[model samples]
Target chain A: MSTIDPTGHPNVHQTAAELATGDKTDTLLQTDGLRKDFGGFTATDEVDFSVDAGELRCLIGPNGAGKSTLLKLVIGTYAPSAGSIYYNGRDITDLAPHRRVRRGISMKFQVPSVYGELTVRENARLPIQRFADGEERRRRVDDAIAAAGLTGYEDVAASVLSHGQQQQLEIGMAAALEPDLLLLDEPVAGLDVAEREAIAERIVRLNEEEDIAFVVIEHDTDFVASIADEVTVLHNGDVFREGPVEEIKADPDVQRIYLGDEQ
Target chain B: MVANTTDGAGSADAGGPMDALRRRIEGPNTVGNSRGFWIGFTVAVASLVAYPLAVGSYQASRFSLFLVYAFLGLSLSVVWGYAGVLSFGQVVFFGIAGYTFGIVSVNFATPLGITAAFLLGVMGSALVAAVLGYFMFYGGVRDVYVTIITLVSTLVLHTFMAQTAGDEWTIGTAALGGFNGMPTIPTLALGVGGAAFTFDSVTFYYFVLALLIATYLGLRAVVNSDYGRVMVAVREDEDRTRMFGYDVKRTKLAVFTLGGALAGLSGVLYASWGNYVSPQVFELAFASLPVIWVSVGGRKTLLGAVVATVGIEFVRNSLGGEWAFIAVGSLLLVFVLGLPGGIVPWIHRAYVDARGDATASNPPEAETVEVSD
Candidate 1:
């Protein structure tokens, strides 16, 4: 028998039952029966999503599939209209953006948001200052800059950097905070193959070396397959399909909805 | 403040002539410590110190009035430039301090009374700013709304004060004299009880100059601190800064209150110098004057604000009549249209370009190589 639950998450009853029964102990971030409504319109409806500790996950969907909105809900940029969000096994659905940062969560937006007027070093210094001070602040800034492959451009203003470099600097600055989980929206979107490869390698290195969990939103299937351990596909704000990268790639349903197959 | 800005690279790297030149070009621009800045500061100080000796007492007294206005410009620089709070009601604090000092000094007519007036006037300005800032920031008022609210408040104050000319408007022993203003307000003096000695014109000029120097240095230290860095960051991007874990509202409130206190202190000096307090201090024209000076000089740089204030005032005094206003108004238009970054940034840009040209001849040990886009 098919059943519809009122709370919005496509399988609210099943998800709530699983959560109540403590079926997901290793989850670092979990959103159950999540729904977001704007006025009379529903933007994110009945979405259940989770990321495991030390896991690299990719979220993919067609345009208006509510992928970005889901990320905002997780980062507390957009308050969920309904449902609960738990991080590290504790409810943190109402924390403000800064409080979330203090709890070791960081995010990079689709457009590079580095301070254009500030020097590259200054950009690194701002986020690093929150975590370290004295000589340690300098060391971390240097390390982040080096990791981003921007050592020589330290004194130059961030506005002069090319698009890909700016994105690198944003990731490098986020890394300086030493966050436990990182959420990047379109990190390598619109870059050439070389630039895309450079950023992909950096992300893989950071995930493996620092043991940082990432939920990257991307449309590039090849890049996703290279980095993402598991993939989540959303269609009209419902989890259409989710599985290992290869299985999701082979799924005829995902291909029809996301891979542009005509019905 | 700027104490941690530099390492002793000069002594350690005291080597070839090329290294010496490069080091000189990159010296710490802390307070008035850069080579060019130090020279200009010394020259200005010497000239001001030698002014009373060179000019008549009347001229020196007039110059002292210009010094008072310089404080107004600096106050605006702190509030508007660093913190990004565009307050059109700065004259509100200035007027409060002037009236408060005048009323207390006239009513009590004692050293303790004058002291009480100064403390209360400055503190009262700070308290009012704190309350207003908290409401505006916490209430989530838009930036344009904040500016309009402050401007409207100034107009309200001017209209209210202008109506208080009646004899019924007496506070304690002092009358609110209305648009005609309260004349014969007591001058500031040093000493305890009633034994205070009044300062002569020359003495007062130096006293005010000393206060100006101290204020300039104190503000320099403030804007150089980590607090100052976060303040500039807030100005650059408020939401991005908030996400980075800084309390944007508290920083705005603190800087706003600090700016008010500085204006209040400036007002006390103005009241003392003029020996009068007036409702006209809250007038719209008076309120707009400091904005003009700071924008013309360069808002981001404190020295630019002071220099613009003093230089423009000196020309205004020389030109006399309404020509001063006309000249200042024309100059303000030119600056707003042509040099939006203001004079200081323009000068810094020119200096950097010249340095870059010089360094182009000899490649640096590590040059910035652009990565592939």
Candidate 2:
């Protein structure tokens, strides 16, 4: 199980075995039978999923596919109606979002959450100060600013940031926490090609160099295909298919749900 | 993580000694700047030392009143500025403390010193605020609900105090003092060696100044600490702050209590200076006044709140009557509409711009660079 490579695609048997025995290396996060319901409507059905340490996994499906809901469940933003979530071999089903973050999990919202009245640096410094303290807080804030390519614009009010830059600053705030698992919801939702590429490249570099795990929710199939090692497709609050980018892209069910009958 | 190597930058910018002086006068660019801390500290000390000597007895008494108002404004700043809780009932705490002091001193004092009466009064008021804050903060009441609940609480307290004054079982009448308020309240006594010193207007001014300075420094420390950062983060984005491992309710409660205690302290000084306690102190108008002071002063800066309190009082005193109200009201409008950043930000901005350095006009730009990894 330890020798099974999680680089190209997931090995379900190995992943399941590792999850059962509470193995720490391959799985940074695992969800078993996770479910959520809003009123009578089920937003997330019973689901099983895992992301290996240092892997970039993308969650994709058409609108109303429960991708965002699943993300919320994983981060404890929304408590599961049933089922449990595990982070690094520990059950964290009841942990609060901030506690989850302190346990090395952080999420960037689809909408930019930077303080509009504060400068870009001040916005980033807030979370840095929250998650890190003393010298490390200052250092992480500086590093995040640099990583986001916001060097000279520190004093610029967050309100002044272009939409793309605001998105990058949100990512910078998450990265400043030095999370083991970073969840990004539609990171490039409003970016131009250049901005999207810059963000995509930063995501790739962070994954390769820092060995950070990521669970990204995006509608851009091409962007997901470019960065994702494993892609999971959700449909109607259930996992429709899960496999390597190429295989999932080629799957008939995935094509039916995402690309329509013409495909 | 980059090591901060900008420690020597303050001295290395030898554009001239004047440049360094300009930077010092301009204040720190960041909310968390050590230079800003020192400048605030120096100014606070100067105000404490100088104010009592500069004013005559009448003005000294007025300045004492201004300091008490400043304390109340500071309290509002903490709850509204740091925790993002707008409390409309703060004056109830002030009134409660004043009435408690009046009742206790008039009735219970031969047994307890006037000092004991004062302490109990302040503590009693703080206790009431804590009870209210727990329900407001931890009971899931937020924003407008919190504001309305507090305003309602103020109305209830005002009615209760007014009724208590009219009741036979209560101390009643001039003892608690209904509409007219209590008089002949004892002066705060201080002893050096074996001699006891009674506070005159000059002495009261210095004493209140010391308390104000202490409150300022203590609050400044809290605002700059890790806990302070958490409180401000809560203000900026509560969900994010909570996601960062803070118990938002607990932080809010703590700030509310601290603010309440400060308000009570102000109440003690107010009763001392006026020699009075009355239901009128708890009126809705008095309750709403500090909120305006905070808004006009600049919500984020403690010094700004104090300056606005004094400035507004000065304007009100010079003009008097309806014209005074109009003048202060007009200035408040100008501050709200024309200078929303408040007087302090304008002063800071002018000082920075006048330095005539490239970074001076754009200090935030420099801060941005320091943040870049």
Q: Which digits, one per residue and each the tens of the lDDT, describe model 2 over residues B1-373?
A: 1122121113325577845543443212223233544566688678667765776677777877888788899998888877788899888888888777776666644423567767887798788888998987768798999899989988887787676544463563236545666776666654433465566788888888888877776776677555666777788788766655678888888888878877888887788788777777778867877877888887777777787887787777777787876776777788889988777767755644554433334534232211211
DockQ of each: 0.27, 0.27
**Runs off by more than 4 Å, candidate 2:** A1-26, A130-138, A259-263, B1-55, B107-112, B166-184, B190-196, B317-334, B354-373
TM-score of each: 0.86, 0.82
- TM-score for the B chain of model 2: 0.81
- Candidate 1 Cα misplacement greater than 4 A, ranges: A1-23, A32-35, A38-40, A89-91, A256-263, B1-33, B194-200, B320-322, B357-373
lDDT of 1 by residue, B1-373 (tens): 1222231123224578854543433322223334455567779898999999999788898899899888888888988888788888888888888888888888866766777777777788777778878899878775778888888878888888888888799998899888888887777765676676666688889988998987887777677655776877787777667667777788888988898888888888888789898877888778888888889888887888898899888898899887878888898899999997688768756754554533212223333335432
Worst 10 residues of 2 chain B by lDDT: B1-10
DockQ of 1: 0.27
Top-scoring candidate (lDDT): 1
Docking outcome class, model 1: acceptable
lDDT, model 2, position A96: 70
